[model samples]
Structure formats: structure tokens, C-alpha cells
Target: MRFSLTCLGRKKPRLLASEILKNVEALKTPAKPLRSQEAEFIQAPDLSVNPFFQQLPPTLANFFKKYPPAPFRKYADKPVATNAEDANPFLPNKNPVTGRYAAPKYSLRRQSDLYKAAYRFGIAHLLPKLGNNKKFYEDKHLNKTPVRGSVMFKLTKGERTKDSRIQEVNEALSKADEIIAEHRGRAYRRKLERKSQQTTPWF
Candidate 1:
């Protein structure tokens, strides 16, 4: 399966790097220090037993399509009591991970094992979701075209302004100032050119 990761935003690159580091750290059991330039591939198996896998969004759906459902027994319709002392009505004997129970019910250690298994499975299942953001950029040449004004420009001028006269005055003044600035710049440039022409050339 192809896997990739895409990150955007001011700090997203750093966050992505840290996440990668964490995943690499999980490989420490093999007694190897992860190098930054190592190959960008990891082997992960789907050990997920959570029934909630089917309910995940499309971004996660692609990852789970490869793995089989986790092995878990469904919870019974009703709690089976061995004795009045053995069963607590509110504290029903059941597996928290599967929301189900076996004959004698799973002990704390068994339940913890199940949880760890679920966790390993969960990480494997989510790898694809993390990698779904990859993309490729295509470059192309396009013909230049005159850009049309926005639809808002079709509205009557007075429709937007409270007083057209005031707006006209402001616009005229703005244009006048622009023209004045241009004239001043041209005058300064001509003065410099004239000064340069008047300079006596030294042999």
C-alpha cells in the first residue's frame, strides 16, 4: 500500500516531524536508533478488534479495508450470574473493549491485554488516514484573457454610496493627487537629466 503524509501551516511541518519521530521511537524494541534519512516506509499489521472500526470516516476507511475484524466475543443479551455473591447487578462482568463477556468474564489482566492488542491494531489502522494527504502539483501554460469586473460592479454607483456628489469629489481629488505626483516625479527626473547634460566631460 502506498502511504504518504502532507502538512501545511506555519508549525505543521515541525508537528509532522515530531509525529514521525514518535512512530520511529515505537520501533526501539528492535534495539535500533532511527536515522532521519532512513527509508520512508514501515510495516504495520492491522490487529484492531474494536467494533467501532466500521464507523470511522472515509479518511480512515482506506486503512481498515486491509485488516480483518479483531477476534472478540459479543456481549451476552443478559448477564449470567454464577451466584448472588459473584454477580453485582450494577457492576456487570464484561469486557470493556468489546462491550461483551465470556463464560467466566475476563480478568483485569486479560482485559488489559485485550486493550493493548486493540491499541496496536488501532495504530496500524490509522496509518493510512495519516498518509492520505499526499498530493502532486501539475504545471501548465494558459492563454491570457481580459479579466471581467465583479458582478458587484454592475450595480448603480448611487446604490452603494449615500451621496454620489461627495463620492465624485473624493474620486476626483484622488486622481488629481496621483497626476500631481506623476508630474512632480517627471519634473525631478528631467532636472536630473538636464544637470547631467550640463556637466563638463573630463577627458
Candidate 2:
């Protein structure tokens, strides 16, 4: 009697063995390396020659090239109007119907005062303390102290206008600049000390 082996109910004849061997050989062969298949890497684009920078005006483009975005400074020198009433005219006006006071409106005088104040104080931030009260404004001794908001609100508006607002703003700006400069100097000194510590030989 003769016998033949079968797989999945199909008989494989002896003549098909060569084809099966060829398939197994193909599977055994190694694939090409991944590095060989990839393209070479290229360098990043140059930002200085970018099309966007080329389109800007010369002064603005130069500014962008030289400095970072934050903490930009612009300076202006002009005579400040010392007269409080002339500078802040709106302080005098009262609402006739309700008898409540309104802050200075946008008259030419007020605008001039606003410009002067902005220049004196720097445009970024306002002075923290400001006001006019009988205790602060009227009393000669108390006027030396900082004005409180609640007391300032109760006083007649005219008293506030009499005080030299421009001078007050100038004083505030001077104080702020002094404090900023001191802090910055301290920070820079600390940085230098740290650098020295890193480089110096330990005994």
C-alpha cells in the first residue's frame, strides 16, 4: 500500500517542492537598512533674509533686528504746563441734574495735560497714589503726606485743581525711576557674583 501526506485537506505533489523552497528562501533574505533609504537632511532657513523682514520700513526693520519685542523706550522733551486748572479743566465741571462730579473730559486743555502727564509718568504705568482732600490738600502739614482716595473724594474739586499736577507727576516719575535703577543694579551685581563663583578656583 502507498500513502501521501496532506495539509488543510489539500495534497502536495512531489513536483511542487521546488516552488515552496524558493518562497522560503525569499522570506529568509534580509531587508535594506532604514538609513540607506532616507534622504540627506538640510539646514534651516535664514531669518535675516526672510521676505517678511525685507518688506518693513527701514527704521522699523532695523529696530526689529536690533532689539527684542518687550520694554521699548521712546523719549520726548516738552515744556509741561504747571497750572492745575489749565491742565485739568474737567475737574471744575459738575453734573447739573444729579450734582455728581465727572472726571476731566477731552477738551484741548485736558488733552494737553494728559500728554504732559503721560510723558512725565512714562506711558506704561500710572502712579499708585493720587488724590486731593481737605486733610491732605488744605492742611499745610498734612499736605506733605500721601493723599488717601476716600478723603480725596469728599473734598471740593477746585482744591484738587489748585495743586500743581504736573509737578506731582514729575516727582512720582523720578521716584519710580530711582527705584527701578536701584533694583536693576542689584540684579546685575548678583549675576556677576554668580559668574565669578562658577569660574573661581576653590581653595
Candidate 3:
């Protein structure tokens, strides 16, 4: 339920074999919508945000270069990192039914398979239109394109190095632990087992 990856010498750790097995087990029961709401009544998010595409340098924007906004934020110009709370796809709209921050049915499924399907559906429709428009400045022969009002790449790089990014990642990881603590009893046991195994001396 909770996954932590400690970067070792800048290397990203891979998931443990058993952890992968646990994830497979968790996936056995395909996730479903929490409740049946009028699908039409549910408001979906603006599909303008594509995590991968949006993170690109907009200066390279061209007919084929689409600089989508970062999800949760109107643009990547915000003072937040990739894992910031605002970056959470499930973040509630400014208004809510139950509380100040409540997400609708469609938003609740952002982390689920259903959301993925919808995202693909949106991209399939949007990509072609983007491909056709040659509005952004470009060097036709060289195939070089530049985005209007694009932030310098160095500015973007500096933001990632700021302390805010580290704090945001830590907070996100803590929230994950809280969620896992609630429903991952076996996971906790396994965590302890693995910790112990790592320290046990052999012969």
C-alpha cells in the first residue's frame, strides 16, 4: 500500500519482487467507482494538462509541440513541484458538496484505471487537431519551433532544486504511509520482515 524509494547514489530503486507480487494481488479486484452517480452529471477536468507533455520546454512549442498545462495547476509556472498537493489529480475543485475541498465522482477515479481510459480518449481526439495547427513559430526547413512567452529552461530547473520540491515529496510520502497504515496490515508485517532480514547476520 505504501511504497518508498530511497535514491541511492542517484539510482532509483526498483520495486521488490514480493512488493510487485503484492501489487498484483491488490489489482485482482479491479477498482470500481465508489458509487454510482449520474455519469453525465459529473464534471470532468480540463484535459489540457498532460504530465509528460506539459513538463517539456514550451520554447520548443510547434505544430507537433504541444505545451499542455500541468494538472492541478493552471500552468507549470506555479511555485510547486511535480508531487505537490496541488499536483494531485484528485485534488477537489474549489467548491465541494461535503467540505471546502471535495472532488466529484469523475475526479475521484483519477488514480484508477477508468481515469486512464478517459485520458487516452481525450488525447486521441486532441492530438490530431494539435498536429494540424502550425501557429507556433518554427523554422520549416530545420523543423525547429519556438513557443511564445516560454519560460527559460534554467528557471524551470531552478524551481526543481528549491526546498519546496523536497518538502512536497516528503509530505506526499507521509500521506501515502497514513493511507497504507489504515488498510495494509499484511504490508506492515512484510515491511518489518524485510527490515529484519536485511540486518540478520548470516552464519
Candidate 4:
């Protein structure tokens, strides 16, 4: 009975692990240190190349790749295709590296959105029935945002009159003038010092 090559290989005796260790120990060369700390780094001789293997001149080196000779060139008479014919244009493309056919990806939500968009193009104006665009407000006021919930600033109780605004400005200017006069007055300063001294103890 003829045994298969793999069966014969399996039947063969494997070398003992102890014998391998004994043979390795017989060598005169010292065993390499187990720890990296004990091991000294030695530069490989192959890394330092010979002078003969120095970089060849550009003349000797190939500038462009040579075209590989085709063994079968019997189709030379056949007309070269100008416009390539597609086998299946609708089919999903394959990934070259993975060698797996790619699945066609589609967004259902985007499709639904597109379907929804098809119904509406723009605002449709009914010219004949379009009523007069008469604007109606409870009161005529510019600062509507403040009265509304989106309050950027507080609204005044009543509208300010031109005379009242001018009067307020004049009052403010008079107050400023009075403050300047008080600052320049030596008598006012003396009065202030006496008041402060009376309010607080000397200690």
C-alpha cells in the first residue's frame, strides 16, 4: 500500500527539543545574552557596501522602462476599439484590492426629499383673488421687537416730546456746570472737610 506524501511526512520522527539544545551548546562560540542590557550592538557588514557595488553612471542605467515582449500577438490585425463597449453600466463597481463586488449605495431620505421637492417649484400667486395688502397694527410704533417677547431693550411708558427732550438736555448741562463750579470752589472744599471731621473721630 502506497502512503500519501503528507501521511509519510507525519509518520516521520520529529527531532527532540533536548537534543537540539545539546547540539547548540557543543559550539565554542558563547551563547548570546538573553537580556538587551548585556547584548552589545554590532554593525552588519552587509550594510557597509563594497566600492564595486557603487551607483552606476546614468549612461549605464536605464532611463525608461522597456516594453515586455508579448508572446501572443496574433490579434494585431484586429481593429483597435475606439469607443469601449460597456457590459453592464448600471452595475456597481468592484474594489480592486479587496476583490469584492461593491454594493450600490442609495439614501432613501434624500430620495423622499427629492419626491417632496417635485410638488413645489415656487409661491403660486392668485392674481384675481389677491386682496389689498392693507397692513393693520394696534398702534403705529417702530420698536416692535422690544414690546414682543424678543426684548432687546425696555420700552418707554409714553412718547418723548421735542420740548421735553430739549428741557432734559438743558437740565443735564446745568447740573454739569454746577458740579464744575463746586469742584473749583475753596469754600465748598472747606465745608466738605469740616463735615467729614465731624462725622468721624480723630482716632
Candidate 5:
């Protein structure tokens, strides 16, 4: 369930493979809407306060550039590293059913919203093609038990050195980008298992 990748020197421990896996798994699922009337909806966060795109690895960042997350002009600006929690795409909109709405939640433990935007963007890509048919959105994308998974990317239980954290994000993003590109926006463990076993740093 977990793997460790120490830096070349072994003196500086890089991020753990398990931690990187957690981030990648989180982005696969869309955030669930609050069904409770009291469930608060999040507001559109200022890119300054919580950036979603800028912090992403280059592959994903460029993809969003080619396909903007929103038509808003603010999206054009470079987003800085968010303290996790920025990955949720639902923040800008309130649940039509649950009137209660609020702003995005932040945590030092969560990964930014960057990778998730990719999957939802794929959902967006599928949307226009469907025209009025909203079945995918209603049944799959928004479904609580999405056939996919969550976009959480929870932080490790303990504090990690800055470099380890960065590496974790980088590896997760890289793995995620490949999944998005190859599967037409879906990832499953079985398919990943089919990949040629490769190691980083060429140990």
C-alpha cells in the first residue's frame, strides 16, 4: 500500500510513494454536493487567497492553459501554491437544492485542486459533446459514490520536510497526467498494473 523513495544521497529522504499515491487517488473523484439544507456552499475563492492552477505540475498547468477552468479573466493570472483544499471545482457554484453556500476550505494537509480540475475538465469536455443530455453529470460526476473516487489528496499524518512534500506532489502529478492522457480521463489500478515497471532516479 506504500513505498518509499529516498533521495540519491539517502541523507535527504524524498517523498514516500504512498503519500504521492494518496494525492493522485484524491483527484479522481469530484467533490460531493451537500445534500443537507444546512450544508454550506463555498464561494469563489480569490486566486490570491487560494490558487488552484499555478501550483500544478507543468503538464497539468499547460493543459488548463489550453483549456481554461472558467471564462473568468482572473483565471488568466498565475495561481500560486494553495495550501491544499483549492482542488474542489464546486466552490464557485452552490447546490441548486441546498441553498446554503460558502467559500473553499483550506488545510496544510491537503494537496491543491490542480489535478482534480483535469478530471472535471474531462467531464466538461464530455459535457458539450452531450448537449442537453446531463445524465453523466447527474449520475456519474456528481454521484456520491462516483464510479471514480475523491479529489481529497490528504496530507501525511506527520509533518514532512519541504522537499519531500514537493516531490510527492510532483510524482503524483506526473502519474496523474499520464493517466489523464492515456485513458481519455480515467484511471484504474488494473490498467496501471499493465504499465511497464519503471523506477525513478534509475536506481
Candidate 6:
């Protein structure tokens, strides 16, 4: 019976071990070392001096260094005056034709005290309606209508004569001159005060 068992084992057929073992050595070979995923960062080059900026003129280069290139390009077309007189085109000057000093031609809307006084004393009579309800006892409005006419329109023949209108105009001009003189005095005083303050040592 033992011989029969041995015979049966031999007859069971040798399992296909050689076929399974064929690729075992290949599998045992270590995989190629995995490629590193960490990135290498190289330092950027220095930019203390720019070649383009070096090529520019000294003044232009200095200006560009202080201000960006965009604003310089944007305002390049605008004119810049070096002094105050050049900046103000309407500055007072002697009229060549008249041989007289002429004040700067300013618009009537400018908020100058002299101009206000001139308009109040000189041109106030042209409109009487403005004073119809306003009180004149406090020197607010015109006490009497200097010219006889509707508030908005002028009369062909008014109660006031040409002489009276001339007188009013003269009075107005004198008042405007006084106001201008007073303003100049005040400005001079202020300038002196500022100079004194600057000269005085704070510490």
C-alpha cells in the first residue's frame, strides 16, 4: 500500500513551478530611484542700476528716479512756468497804446472785496427792485433809487441827471480805491508778521 501511495504521488503530475518562477527575479529588481519632485529656485539678478536710466540726461534721469515714468509721460505736454508773472497771463501792465497803467481784466464774478464795493456803490442803482423790501437804515440796501426806471429796464428820461450818475460813479471808484488800499496795507502787515515769526527762534 505504501508503494501504491508513492506511485500515486508521482502520478499527481509535478505542478508548473518553473513557469511561476520565471518572472520572480525580474520582480525582485529594485525600481529605478523615483525622480525628485522638489523644485530648484535660482536667485534673480540684481537691478540697482538700469541701463536705460543711465542713458537718459542727468536732469531727466533724476526726475524719473523721483517720479514714475507714466506720470512724466502723461503731463509732458503741459506747460510749466518757472515764475509767478509768467504763470499769470493777465498780470497788470502799462498799456502801450494808452500810456497808462491798466489793472488786470478780471471777470466780475471774482470774489474781491473791492469789486463788491464798486458794484454796490456804482451799479446798485440800476436795479431798484432789490431794495423794495430790504431795509436801508442799517446801510444794507440803497436808501433811494438813484435812477428812475423799472427794476429791470432803464428809462428814456430819468429823474437823475447825467451829472448825478457821474457823481455816483466817482464815489464808487473812490470807495473801490480805498478798499484796495486797505487790502494792500493788511497784506503788507501780514507779510511782516510772517517774517518776524520766522526770524524768532522757537527753541
Scored by lDDT, the top model is 2
List residue ranges in candidate 3 displaced over 4 A: 1-161, 171-179, 190-198
Give model 5 RMSD, 1 decimal.
39.6
lDDT of 6 by residue, 1-203 (tens): 24566655655566587866867877888877544432212433222255654555454444334433332222222222323222221234455566665553332232132224434445322221221134333355547565554565654555447778889999989787456657788776676568768865688
Q: Against the hidden reference, what TM-scores do the models get?
A: 0.15, 0.16, 0.15, 0.16, 0.16, 0.15
Runs of candidate 5 with Cα error greater than 4 angstroms are 1-50, 72-138, 141-203
Q: List model 1 lDDT by residue over 1-203, tens digit each.
A: 65445433344335588888999888875766666445323534333433566555443444235322333212222454434332422224555457665343333443344334445445432221111122222211233333576534656767767587888888989787456657788776676668778968798
lDDT of each: 0.45, 0.46, 0.45, 0.38, 0.45, 0.44
**Cα lDDT tens digits for candidate 5, 8-127:** 336655789998899999998798876754353455544333365456556556544443444432321222223222233223223345644434332211212333344564524311
Instruction: List model 3 lDDT by residue over 1-203, tens digit each.
Output: 65555433356678999999999999897877655455535756333344655543333223123323333233222223333344322233333334354342223322233323324445322222221223322324457455755644546766868888888888989788556756878788688568768865688
What is candidate 4's TM-score against the reference? 0.16
Provide the lowest-lDDT 10-residue window in model 1: 128-137
- How many clashes does the backbone of model 2 have? 0
Cα misplacement distance, residue 77 of candidate 2 (Å): 24
Instruction: Please provide, for model 2 over 26-102, each residue's C-alpha lDDT reduced to its tens digit, 9 standing for 90 to 100.
Output: 99999865563252234434446677656654544443444322334221122123232222232334455666555
Candidate 1 ranges with C-alpha deviation above 4 Å: 1-73, 81-103, 123-203
Candidate 6 TM-score, true structure as reference: 0.15
The global Cα lDDT (0 to 1) of model 1 is: 0.45
Worst 10 residues of 2 by lDDT: 127-136
Q: Which stretches of candidate 6 lie over 4 Å from their true place?
A: 1-48, 71-203
